[model samples]
Every structure is written in C-alpha cells, then in structure tokens.
Target: MKTNKLILIFCLIFSVHSFAQPKMEEKKEQIRALKVGFITNELKLTADEATKFWPLYNAYDDKQFELRHQKMKAFKGRMEADLDKMSEKEAAALLAQMESNEDELYQIRKKFVTSLKGILPSVKIIKLKKAEDDFNKKLLEQYRNKGPRR
Candidate 1:
C-alpha cells in the first residue's frame, strides 16, 4: 500500500538522520569499549558469561563514575581555592576531603564487588579486582612517564 511505502521511507530517513548527527557520544562509547576489552581479557570470559557480564559491568561502572565525579569536583574546587593562599584550616579541610573521597571510593568499590560476586563466580570476581588494580597501576605508570599534564 502507499501508506506502508511512505512509512518505510520515513523510517529510512530517520535512521539516516540519526546516524548523521555528531558523534559526541562516541568518546563515552570508546572508553566503555576499552573497559570491556580490559575486563574481558582479564576475566577470560566465555561467550555466555560475557553476555551477562558486560551489562552488569556497565551498570557498576556508571555508579562508580557518579561517585568519582562528585569527589573530583570537591577536590578540584578545594585545590583551586587553595591556589591563592594556603592555611592550616585549608590544609585540614583538604585532608579531610581527601580522606572522605577515599572512603567513598572504597565503599563504591565494595558495593560493585558485592554486586559482581552475586553474578559471577568467586574466581571471576578475584580476576576482576586484579584487573582493576593492574589497570590503575599501568595508568599511573603512564602518567608518571609522561610527566606533568599540559
């Protein structure tokens, strides 16, 4: 029918237009893909496990990012404030903030680990933790070798 033909044309145009839009979301997707690559290799996930693991991992990562962003904002704000002048009060506040951020990060990690354990075997959970540590170590080394940020 003509109506069906028109509907198909509209759908095609919409799909094309969507794809034509800017790839602003691509950076997030690339980072996510890199994370999955790291996890998949480290965990040695089987196809069936991967199917379940990625979705859960993504959810866990999103929550971690939320917590981290909050801590980062607070830390950066304090550091900016301290640039003009430093005082014992400022130092104490920064120390407390840093400690709180560490605690929050630890708590977030614990929650993610618990959730992951519910979905994965103990060995896989251990692997995930090791992978995270290894990733952090490598990232730190890279930054150290690169010198100060521009």
Candidate 2:
C-alpha cells in the first residue's frame, strides 16, 4: 500500500512537470529574443556583418550550453546534499572537480575566441563580450526587482 502511494506521488510529480514544459520553452524563446535584440542594438552590426556573424555566434552559444549541462550532470548529486556536513576528503574532491570543470570552460572560451578571430574584427568581438555582460546584468536586475520566486 505504501509502495502504491509512492508510485502515485511520483506519477503526479511527473505529470505536473510535463504540463509545465511548454511554458518553460516559451520563456526560453522570449529570453532568446530579448538577448538577440539587445546584442543587435548594442553591437551595431552591419547587415552583411550580421549575416556572417550569427552562425559562428550560435556555435559559441551552443558550446557554452553544452559545457554547462555537462557540469550540471557531473555534479548533480554534489548539490543536493549538505556540503558543510561532508568529510574533508569529499569536499576536497568536490573542489578539485569544480576547478577542473572551470578550467575546461576556460579552454572552451579560448577556443571559441580563436575561432572568432578571422571572422570578426577585434572591436566587434569586444563589443559582443560587453553586450553579453550588460544583457546578463540587466536580466539579473529584472529578476531581483521581481523578488524571490516561489
């Protein structure tokens, strides 16, 4: 009987999550649109430059997404448990793994920058980085203004 109750609860959770997926996707699309608009206006991309720039930019974005997802999956269990209660060895190992992941992300950024060199001028590339930082800061401010989410 307890097992049956547990199964029912699991099913309910899954159904609720599935129902929320469409709205989650809509939010992602909205954010992507906002980001593109912000980048376009901030960078002052020429029509010809935009045409050549977007595909390469998308690849860089995808690499960031891939690296983030990889790190999340790799550290999935590490986040759920209380870190303060963990053994010294466990914490040390976690720190090592985190550092390694950060190094990998840094290398990925370096490679992406190298790939962007011939296609994009240094000024535009710097502008892109600045635009990204500004966009992120604005998003954070908006979220803060909205207060804590449930």
Candidate 3:
C-alpha cells in the first residue's frame, strides 16, 4: 500500500509538471506576440519594410534568447557551487567565462545593428532601440504592480 501511494504521488507530480510546461510556453508566445505588435506600432513599419525587417529581427532575437539562456544556465551552476571552497584558479576561470559570455552577447548586438543599417534608416533603428527599452520597462512595471504570484 505504501509503494502504491508513492507511485501515485510521483505520477501526480509528473502530470502537473507536464501541464505547467505547456502553460509556460503559451505565456511566452503571448508575450512575444505583444512585443511584435508594440514594436511594429512604434516603428510605424510599412508593409514592405515589415516584410524585410521581421525575418532579420526574429533571427537576431532568437540568437539573443539562446545566448541569454546559456548565460543564465552558467550563472545557476555557479550559484549552486560551493564558492567558499573554490580555489582562486577556479574562481578566475568562472569569472573569465562570465566575461566571455557577455562579450559574445555584445558582439551579437553589434552585428544585428550593422545588419539593420542596410534595412532601416538610422533614425528608425534608433527608435527601434528605444521602443525595445520602453516595452521592457512597461512589461516590468506591469509585472511588479501585479505583485508576487501565489
């Protein structure tokens, strides 16, 4: 009877986790849609410009997302390590790895902006950056105002 209860508990936990994963992905999709609309409106993209812009922008966004995921994973691993017991050499290496990740993120941004120069006016590209910042700020403000999730 005890073994059966343990099995049931494990199954329940697994099912809940599976359900939660889809909901998390759904929320990500919704936010992505909202960002697209926000950016489109902010840029005042013409149909021709949007046709040329979104593909390049989406590719750049995907690369940035992947790099951020890698950086966060590395950060989490470092957090889990016993820093007090770590050697100077190991700590230096981790610091170097963190710096390298940041440099790579910067390089990707530089390349994306350079590519945008060919597709957009400098003024519009600057506006794109502002729009991105504004969207992020608004999203953060909304999240903060909502308070902590239960």
Candidate 4:
C-alpha cells in the first residue's frame, strides 16, 4: 500500500539522521582504546610487566563493569524519580541502593589496587592513577571544547 511505502520512507530517513549522531557506546570504546595506549606509554610497560599486568587489569575492569551495569539496571528508573514528590520509603530505598553501589565500587577499587601491587611496582601504580585522572580530564576538556551538540 502507499501508506506502507510512506512509513518505510520515514523510517529510512529517521535511521539516517540518528546514525549521524555520535553514539555513546562508540565514544566509550574509543576512550577505552585510548586509555590502553595512554597507560601503556605512561607506565613505560616492559614486555614482562605488560604481560602480567594486562590480564589482571582486564579482570578488574570486567568486574567493575559488571557492578556498574547491575546498578544501572537496578536503579535506572529510580534515579529519574522526582525528589520532592518521591515518598520517604522510595527515597530511603534509592539512597540505600546508591550507598551499597558506592561501597561495592570502593571495595572493587581496593581489590584492584591490591592485585596491581603484585604485578606493578608501586611507582608504576601511582603513575597509572595519575594517567587515569589525566585521561579523564583530557576527555572532559575535549567535550567542553566541542561545546553542546545542537
């Protein structure tokens, strides 16, 4: 039918326009790739250190990602709730969940630091922290320089 054809045309245009936008997932992967290279260079990782470091680093990242994904799924709707209209019970629950997530995030970082201690020198680990902070700062700066998307 003509209506069906019109609908298909609309979908095609919409898909094309949406595709032009910078996707968040792609941006994240790009940053992640850059971080790998940045950290490798910053640490001046030798073959031996890189070999031992990457596997442990990857495991820690995976755990952290899992925890974050879990929190997103659990709190996605709750996070967007209106504060003033939210019941005390709902607010308390959301706060408790947020607190729990923060605690878990901190614990994972502590565990990651402990694991890194076995693989990297303390100096390299310190450099790694600085490198991470620098990478984030640079990423933020780039976003700011780009200004808001229309």
User: Residue 51 deviation, candidate 4, in Å?
Assistant: 0.9
- Model 2's C-alpha root-mean-square deviation from the true structure amounts to 13.9
User: Candidate 2 regions off by >4 Å?
Assistant: 1-22, 148-150
TM-score comparison, 1 vs 4, better candidate = 4
* Consecutive 10-residue window with the lowest summed lDDT within model 3: 11-20
Candidate 3 residue spans exceeding 4 A from truth:
1-22
**Scored by CA lDDT, what does every candidate get?**
0.70, 0.74, 0.79, 0.77
lDDT of 2 by residue, 33-120 (tens): 5667677777777677778777887787887878788776878788679978999999889889888888988888888778778777
**Whole-model lDDT, candidate 2?**
0.74
Q: For residues 1-150, what per-residue lDDT tens digits would candidate 4 score against the true structure? A: 343344445544554454356887765555565667667777888778889998888788888888898776889877676778989898898889889998998999898899889889999999998988997797688669867788
Residue 134 of model 4: what lDDT?
91
Clashing pairs in 2: none
Q: Model 4: how far is 37 from its true place, Å? A: 0.9
TM-score for each model = 0.63, 0.75, 0.81, 0.76
lDDT of 3 at 51: 88
With candidate 1 superimposed using the best TM-score fit, by how many Å does residue 54's alpha carbon deviate from the native? Answer: 2.4
Per residue, candidate 3 scores C-alpha lDDT tens digits across 71-137 of 7797878868898998999889888888988899899999999999988899999999999999899
TM-score of 2: 0.75
- Best-fitting candidate, scored by TM-score: 3
